[model samples]
Target: MRAKHNVLLVTNDHVSTLTGMADNTITVSALDRTKVKINGQEGVGRDLSLHAVATGKEYVHETSKDDLWFFFDVEVASNPALAGVAGFTTFVMILFIISYWNSAGSSTALVLVALQILCFFCINPYLIALSDWRNFMTEEAEALMHSSVGMNKALKSVLTLIVLLTISIFAFLMLKSVLPDRSIQDMGDWELWVAMLFDSASLTLPFICFGLYTSLPLQVVQILASFPFLFMIFFSTTFSPGAGLEGVKGLRFLFARFYLWCVIPGVMEGMEDCPKDNLTLYTVLSGCLGLFLFLGLQGVLYVVEMNKANAAAADFKALQGSDEFKQLQVEMKYVHTDGTPRGFGQTGVDYKDGYEATATEDSTITVSGGAEPPANEL
Candidate 1:
């Protein structure tokens, strides 16, 4: 007779199930040097492999969901240290200038308000870019997860929500300081709040319209700059196994299959074109590209305005007070140095001739004196 036994073994790499004859003993090794798995995928693990065979990077490692975010979304906004300083300092200085000037009854406060308004407007186009990119990334993340090769969609959604919330907070605080008392009251109304949503959209028009006014000629230049890079991303993803298996195909196909259905018709309507799918994508890309130009142009203009205001303020301060300038006079008074009555002069004549006569020598003096005494007596 024979007894039966079963064994279950689990390890980091694999699971094993074994059945043996009754009363049989088997030896199993815990750490097997002969076998290893490369990140849950079969094969493709070696210690002493040639450079040519192993030198190339894995597509999964090099081009993936997180890598896309790193390159397209996060890298530009990274270096949080610098970004933090820029955001905080600009916000603080603008707020301080607006508040301090207004409180001190300075007429320049209105200019400060105007600058703040410009800044408020300038940030909108950036917000549009950020929001569109967020939507794009969210879609890509969804595609990856749908293909069952990425992180959970819930995490991505949560992260995107957090990013949007942070942006909203920054924008709110930035614009709040510039609102007048009456504007604050109006903002408290629900109807006004509803109106604000549309108003906000129109506010972004300044950024775009200003750009159109200033740099219409640069339209082609801007599009050309983004074309090659866009081509690379479109080509790489289109040909990629991950993208193909996920059925994204290429940029146009991916848009046609996915985004076109969602955003295209509205874009076409905005462009006042027929609902044909051919022109939909061009309309969408053109709108996005136009927004990029708008941001760059308005950003440059706003900076120039601030610089002009700063220079004018400096010049005003330089000329405000100086000893070389004096008030006008209505009357004049004269003063004398030496107290002379009007203008006067004095003159003196020669010495007195009849006052004294010289005496003669000593010997002749006696006779001469006697004669002079007689003559004087006579």
Candidate 2:
């Protein structure tokens, strides 16, 4: 009677016995941090962001991937206030520069195209010697002069730039040949994607120009400098006019306003004055903004690091002037074991093993000491 009142709980399972068809699947994959060498990786990282590499540097904090488009991949120590102000100002100025080019007529673009071509062919190798920026190259190049490191870096940079320019030139031509006449503008996936590529080059150009100047390891530079575009690549999922990530309309308009201002806000501000149909608007606009930011940080890092190098040099010079080396002081001076006397200022120290040397008034160099008797010998 008590057993009949026992409670029962039921869970879903095979009662009569049923076998569910399944595939035994296993997945395995692996990834590791890629080795990268920048001009002082930590230094470059610090310049790019305000974060400290040290565990305990006070009053400095890093701003990581907070911005929509800006990022510093490495941890770098810098004054937080200075970094904030510089980054903000540079970002604003970039917008303005893009605005200027957005309205510039086809003539300006034509001139730039020609100049870039000239830079690739005629002026690329001599690039490292032509300006103050190239000064960074001097230290490293001097360190590895005539060695494989320098030669390999040089070849890599040249080849990479050639490839970039080829892609740029080809993109330029594709846009020029495909666009409609300049009355009313219509943009589609082809135009948008091409323009994005064209504009994305802006981010890479400064790294190429200055990085080559320093002959930093180009293999890493090639990979890292490509990141800006690579990051924005999600925007290129499609080439259609309506293609873009979902967002507020107001935000889109605001961005469009900025883009037009950069792409072709027409000095006056109308669709006609706007970027309209010009693709290089996309190119010059983003590129110029990227150039501004790069230049700002580059200028800062160059001056700061250079000052450090100079300060270190000065400290070394001061150390060399210390009194320890006044007369090249010796650890031990030699005198005859039999207590023979030699006049002061007459002893000459010889570097020979097992002997101390002295010069007599005859000007003949002589060894004045004998080797200790060996306890064990051949």
Candidate closest to the true structure, highest lDDT: 2
Please give the distance, in angstroms, between residue 253's alpha carbon in candidate 2 and its true position after superposition: 11
> Per-residue lDDT for 181-242 in model 1, tens only?
44434333332222222223223333333332333333443344344335434632322323
**Per-model lDDT:** 0.34, 0.37
- Residue 252 displacement (Å), model 1: 36
| Each model's backbone clash number | 1, 7
Encode model 2's per-residue lDDT on 172-225: one tens digit a residue.
Answer: 444443333241133333443444344435544555655654445654555655
Candidate 1: count of backbone clashes, pairs at least 3 residues apart or interchain: 1
lDDT of 1: 0.34
State the displacement of the C-alpha of residue 54, model 1, in Å, after optimal TM-score superposition. Answer: 29
Per-model C-alpha RMSD: 46.1, 27.6
Extract clashing residue pairs from model 2.
Answer: 46-76, 51-76, 189-239, 202-287, 264-274, 264-275, 266-273
